[model samples]
Target: MYDESVVPVKMESFSGVAAKSPISQCIKTVLGRARVEKRLTIGLLPAIQYLSKNTNGALFCLTAAAPPGDSATHMQEVLLQAFCAENDIYVIKVDSEQKLKKLLGFSETRMDFSCILVHYPYTDPFSDSQEFDTSVLSEAENDLIEHCETNWDYAQMPVIKLPEK
Candidate 1:
């Protein structure tokens, strides 16, 4: 069973953590909800006893090979945030690439980007791919349209920048 305390946290709630741009606030809101909901879904103590560890599922992200503080990485994160804002997927800029890689089960030696997806998973038609179901995506789009008001232009949104180390 996953420890609730170990659940991934957003930058705002993480003590001593701060972000240099407004984009972090948006990222914090989305990731924070996901993290909290994930723990609540898993329940605690005896409730956890009935469910198998695997049934708890996993959080998926569409990460790139970007690292924070690098100019290229900053642009990559901003573009990523715009995309996520468009699709309603949560996005975050992680400074600790090594930490995220390790958490994603990769060896510590292998470093990778930390911008990841928090979308719900569904079965894909391809045997080798994990693409989202089209219907599901469409439904999500409709839901987003119904409930969310968004501005597609990145300038209109709170642009994300790298946090100071």
Candidate 2:
């Protein structure tokens, strides 16, 4: 089981934004887009592997806060954070793994997922396989990027904390 002692980093603490802030909305939208486009990498090992091999996209990572005293989960969280930090990826921490799974449209009995990696590839005009127009997503991404630039300290790992339910 995941530990319960990990403290949540509140969004307001870093960005002064509430739970319903535009940043949160953008995140939801981006996640939806990534899901529809099949650009999301779920689970810790898959995410790590994807990040290790792919560098062609704008990457965003979302992780559930590790339960306190769950050394394995905590270690996974730390390792993921370090990898993201080294790669200049944005990492957002949500309240729990179940909530995150629900947000991703998984059924209640599905395997628990602690981490999700969303990859938004740089648009390729010449590719016929690009079915969806991503202009709206682009706008949301720009907003998120601007928010991060304005509010977060880039020197440290960019981990936006979502309020707990």
Candidate 3:
């Protein structure tokens, strides 16, 4: 997880000639400038922070641990992206390898991948805000968890036995 403070507020207008959408530019700006951290975000701490700060968004991260050359991780990313698309959410690929290691408490030898849903906090403009709707976010999170569980549970492992000399 990174510092929410550094994430620039959503742009009100984008008139650049570049082909990227405003949301893309916003995500790039945030990821490029936000401060990195050494703590794990397993409990969706970032999402909670966004809610508390009233940043008008929520963040959801999907971290997958896989063996070398496994395609499950890639498939999960695709599925998640589609899910985000259907929910009118913006998904960003988080490629901070060092930060991810700290976030997942893994050694450099492990292969992991992550994607984050940039702030999705919902608020009322006319009145004080209450709890944000996290149903879509929760569904996405549950899908990731279920995918990992299924893959890990069915994965084959080699067994070694001591020689009976």
Name the top TM-score candidate: 2
Question: On residues 68-129, what C-alpha lDDT tens digit does candidate 1 reach at each position?
Answer: 35786556556645545554443333444544444334444533435544545445536574
TM-score of each: 0.35, 0.68, 0.33
Q: Which window of ten consecutive residues has the lowest lDDT sum in model 3?
A: 156-165
What lDDT does candidate 3 reach at residue 67? 36
lDDT (tens digit, per residue) of candidate 2 on 1-165: 422333222233133434233555566667777888888888887887887786444367788777688899789788977778667677776656875666677846666578888887547768876343445355556556555555456554344433232
- Rank order by lDDT, top first? 2, 1, 3
Tens digits of per-residue lDDT for model 3, 23-136: 223333333332232212232334334334543343433333333586875565556545544443333333344454453334354443343334433345465655555553
Q: Give Cα-based local distance difference scores for all models.
A: 0.37, 0.64, 0.36
The better candidate by TM-score, 2 or 3, is: 2
Steric collisions counted per model: 3, 6, 6
Among all windows of 10 consecutive residues in model 2, the one with the lowest summed lDDT is 2-11
